[model samples]
Target chain A: MNTTSWLNPLAALVLSPLLPGIINRTKAFFAGRRGQPLLQGYYDIAKLLHKGAVYSRTTSWIFRAGPVVGLAAVLMALVLLPLGGSAAPLNFTGDIILLAYLLGLMRFFTVIAALDTGSAFEGMGASREVQFSVLTEPALLLSLAAMGKAGQIGSGSRIEHLDNFLSLSGIYSNLSASVWMRNGTILLLVAGALLIVLLAESPRIPVDDPNTHLELTMIHEVMVLDHGGPDFAMILYGAALKLWVFSALLAGVLIPVRSAYWWLDAGAVIGGIFLLAVVIGVIESSMARLRLLRVPQLLTGAGVLSILAFALILWR
Target chain B: MTGLTGSDVQGHLAVAVSPLRSVVLISGILLVLIALLAVMRSRLLAGRKVELSGTWDCGYARPTARMQYTASSFAQPLTNMFGVLLQTHRSLERPEGFFPTQAGLHTETGDIFRRNVYRPIFQSVERLLLWLHWLQQGRVQIYILYIAVTMLILLIWNL
Candidate 1:
């Protein structure tokens, strides 16, 4: 509600592209090669925006609508997020559910658009996408629910009057060092679940290989193979923003720096996010992508962790 | 459309409606506007060198719709997951020998409820109804005798 709350979405819009750049640089560092510039993501988007698009004859308006609608959904998710040490610009009880479903909406459009292409490769990608999301979504929601429960415990009687006490802003803002100290195990479990969800949702290593050339092996990237020019730019930027959004959620839990100064809180959260991205980069460098059959098991493991966390909170 | 106007309803209504007002509506408008922006940006910056071509199929000069992913293939993963419940029957004939003659894979998924539940019940109903087939006999005398017997029974009961 405060004027400073605008900083969260603004920061996300401006700096999201950097997270991917940082991750790429980290991977390059591990590979013993000088990486592209940190602003490479921005450059790609700019170049893409400067080019013309080619539409498949098989595609309809849904193909065109995918990137724009997806970007919009991510933007909506970003606005609902509480970052730095403040509430989100738009926060209400049950906004957590909205945040999750907004991502779902984005994915729905992307899948349908891929299907609209009527390409076998894109269809393969879409199948893998929906298949993985079947596991990923439950993990995400359960993890968020766990965090909400932990937040409820932290806020105690204050949120009792509300119909649903699990707003993203409320949960993030309620997270503090003391709460972490008290519920360290639950938070740890939830954080692990969230990290897996982040990697899976963002199409990172282990769950998927973003750089895979074989369409049979790829998931997210293959879905957009037919998109080019400004549409591709939107997709790319939307992806970066999604990674940023998930990173922010994870960082919020990992770094509970709730300070009086908004700048300090924002700085810590953003720093935590960059660190998480570096972690992801290092992970990609060290680990091979999981076998397609194994991805579901990994996602199911995350769900188990979240379920465990929720159980811990419930019984406690 | 009905409106909630009273002050008592305002607080709860506003709280519930804010997400629709702020997130959903804004996102919808933004989707259209940004899509238009993308179109215009591409137009302005592309400098009119746009090209249309077939989707890259690994440079196979000739590609047909038959080779494209079918709806069934698209749903293959999900169907495979629920195969036991769906009862998707599949048959594969792999080509043999140096010069392969024929290869085909056919999959059929039928309605589980109809196959497992409804069909048996309907079959039993048909068999039970078949027992009454002898009543029709294809004869006018049989119908007259049946009517006379019904009339005699009715008179006896009345007496």
Candidate 2:
């Protein structure tokens, strides 16, 4: 109803691709090569929209439904998110669980879609996706839940964990440097855990190699290999949107850009998202993906960090 | 039901369950469906054709399922990470030299708990049954000797 609520989807549509562009540019800088234009994702999506899709002979409606369901789920998730430091278009006492499961819903459809193709590679990727997400999901929710606890900065009677009341606005609405200072260790740990979740959840390096063409090593890419034209485009845009959600969450926490005027805070939050993109690019450039076997250890370590963060908050 | 306490404010911190806007979700789904229909309609209007073919494989004259990595091979690293419990069995036949006859690899990653726990229990039960078979001799003399021994023990006790 309000201008800020209207801005959530508006910003998502126009600005989601920019984060990936920033990341690509940052990676290009580290590699000493000029990357594609920042608008490449937009161009790819447009091209995909114009082209005809190719469905395999063995495929069914499930494959076709994958992108549609996925994009829809992510769209719903965007509604719950308090992007650009504004209250979500949709918010409630416990909206964080809904947001997390919305993404989970996206993943569910994706894996089923991949399975529908009857491709061994897609099945393998689906398995890996599920395995890695098992750890990342807990880390993500727990860290966000920890931030929810931090939201009680000036409140009486604290609720804890995702099972309690991890609201989108509840976490980001009142973030400030003072909040960070009071629970600096807690915030720092949660952020560290969240950074890992962001990387893993978005299929960034260390959990998956987004740039790799080899099927054996693919996780997210291989699952959608059969999709072409508009279908593929939907997947690409959906992924960009998913990345945007994770970035918003991570940036919202790390940037704590609070201003009386809504637009200024929104601008600062957008800037923070781009900055997070650069950080991701730097990380990709600086490290090769972990050995596939060791990925679980890293994810489990993230889980441990979140648990430690949770323990610290409970002790307080 | 639990709550957080603060200097100036008083309220529950985390909501027990996340409240979502079903209307927003329904609208989002509707939009996605419309977009998909539009895509389908455009494809029909444009009459663009699709060519079906095998995925491009490395230029082998003939591509077989064996040439591509199996799911197990693709996930070998992760499986090996938990080799302690997974206990994957591998069988391979390597070519001896440049002019090879045949080479093959088979891998089986079985349920560790079933193998380590259930199999052992069943095996021990089998062994116990085998040991218990000594008492089931079918001869009549064995049965009579058992009864005589019982009667002599009873007579000695009575004296």
Candidate 3:
């Protein structure tokens, strides 16, 4: 590991909550209203942290465990990801699978916690969350695998084993502007699939509205309705971090700025992440959420995109 | 196996199991503890006004355990997706007239392998084994005659 490998994680911990703020501000600009401050996400978490929590009578230790586990899992995932042109803090062979399953662990805890509440709304939300994730996870893994293969091809090293390509840092560090120039089509397809995965995995406007009020219509939001105070703050912060993690992965692909200067690469990746947030905000402002039944089709479309990208890579 | 060092295999195995022993696991526990402390601090800030009440059930007056989501209901979405393979049998009886009858829906998921494969094989095996039942007779004289016939055959062979 490099001396400054820890800088990326530090940046993520400090700047992740800013993503929701930026996204909300962009949405407000589109709506022609004076929006909340750019630091509104931070303010909300702080306010929640200062208040008392209310636990449901039906809930148990699992409910309390959800937010903590989710936060920790996302934190772990944040480390596994390589931001900008820098390698991740922790990387080994097959770390990509670990990254994917870390997110899975977060979701599993969230789902079981929701189920523990015994509320019909939470159960419904949990079921929907699981159903959608079924499609998103495959797209996520396949896209990463395709990108790894692409990176392997681009590097053109004769001595290194193929297993080295399976790590996030290995693949991402190898990727540069030239790689994209050579394999633009496959990367484009993978990028599109990953963007869809990001939208679906995070509670964005198209998949599940973060600002939704009706519990019956909610998916991710409904699962955490019973939590309050610091617990809710952990969840909110965890969500922002989750969004950051996905954005980092997508940004790495979208902007393969492998400059000689470390600062330039890092700055470009961070800027790319913020740009993605703005784009997502604009998408939220312009588009409406899909009907509940049609969400599976959208997710499956992402899966198909990933499979096509992988197949194209294999063909070459 | 011939050239690779033990450290190399250990490294590979370590990578495989690293997710479980990650620093995040320890940090996750610490995070939970911190959250607990924060909750306690918040409680102190609130001056003990955190009220305990029943869950909101859309003003249904009194909510019972039956109104809650069951395990089957929780997995309904996934089950619906794999319905063809599961072949879950559902029986629904709707109330014929308003305020007059009972209505119920029952769903049963049986083990398909036992139904289609194991029972038939076990039944055929039982049938094939029934022919061996004729070896035992009720009388002691019949058993003695069999022993004597075996002895006579052995004596003639010796001669």
Candidate 4:
């Protein structure tokens, strides 16, 4: 039993909320203002938990179930992902596909909850979220596939082990110093695509401004406008975890720092995650959100990058 | 033949499969966590009285739903960018004079292909059918004359 593999999810649970706090702090520093405490998200979640939930008369159980199912689905996905160099605690050959679709299931529930409110703003947010996610999902999966091809060139030919094509470990399992030197372009393109996917999926600046209060321009925020109290806490925590998962995936790809010492590798992966949050914070501080029409263009550009990466890997 | 991600077996048909024991363990932990949160929330809310009130309007007494942005208006920028393709049809009742009553606007984003493509084809077909209405005229005399002409042509051909 690979007992140490459990550290991935435990670390993810304990440290995920710190990510948004760091991003907020970085943004505040750039703006020359004292930010909220680094534990502000944790405080907010605690406060929200103590409050009473207010449900709309128009909503049913599905509205209440949205946060529950979304958080659960994301947790399920976390078990499939390998945050460190080792395999996920629940790793399987095709766990990668399960991870991708589990996220889609989460989005599905969120959209359904938005429509349940029957509010114009929530509906609009739902429409935009689904449409943008349609583009981002392909970019994400294709980029992962391209990166997985890097792992295929281990001790043997990839053609021999074709059945293991969908394993998430295939993205990083066989990363050697020589592989990166030989196929650096493919790695670069895949990283670019994954970066776009991370930003779009996590409601980062270029795709969405999570701090925006203008309902007309909101995407993920407006959808949850009506959810209050404990339900809202669940949603907030779920968002942080979602951000953590994407950040972890991107960091694992960018920083392929594997070691025989499991603790050292886990420490590096965690450090890489925090570094990614700082990079995201700098990016948000630097750029404005894209115009709504321009969003599809950016997503399509990511898709093009993924395709290029895939083609490069296939050629070799 | 192997599946897209390949099969777990050498010759059998099962796809790439793994029993997610970790997921089962995680799910149990998560369920317990959720239950704890629910209990904590209930404990906090127990016997706590709350009141519902109208939304604060920031000193505006005439607070109304109309003040909020409508669905179409909220998505105006996106719809406008795709307006040529979406073919959004809007009917506006512009406010006439000062303080005009009954001023309103309606926007319909119907299918572009149905409105622009099918409508013209359907209208032309209806026009052609109207023109062909003369063939089934309800006059016996004209019908007899048409039959006579047909009989004469056949008789002449036979000769």
TM-score of each: 0.85, 0.75, 0.86, 0.75
Candidate number achieving the greatest DockQ relative to the actual structure = 1
Model 4 misplaced stretches (Cα beyond 4 Å): A154-158, B1-10, B16-159
Local error of candidate 2 at residue A279 (angstroms) = 1.2
Model 2 per-residue lDDT at B72: 72
What TM-score is obtained for chain B in each of the predicted models? 0.63, 0.49, 0.59, 0.47
Q: Which candidate leads the pack in TM-score?
A: 3
DockQ of each: 0.37, 0.14, 0.34, 0.11
Q: What ordering of candidates by TM-score runs from best to worst? A: 3, 1, 4, 2
Of candidate 2 chain A, the 10-residue stretch with the lowest lDDT total is A154-163
Model 4 vs truth, CA RMSD: 7.1
**Steric collisions counted per model:** 1, 16, 0, 1
Ranking by lDDT: 1, 3, 2, 4
Q: What is the lDDT of residue B124 in candidate 2?
A: 97
Query: What is the TM-score (0 to 1) of chain A in model 2?
Result: 0.95
- Per-residue alpha-carbon lDDT of model 2 for A1-316, expressed as tens digits? 4778767677887889877888899999999999989998899888877887667766787877888788878877887788655788776666777788889989999988887776677777888897888788999888888887776652333544432245677678757777777888888888889888889988899889999979879999888988888778878888999998988888887878667788888877778888899999999999999988888899999999999988888788
Considering summed lDDT, which 10 consecutive residues are worst modelled in model 4 chain A? A154-163
Ten-residue segment with the worst summed lDDT in candidate 1 chain B?
A: B41-50
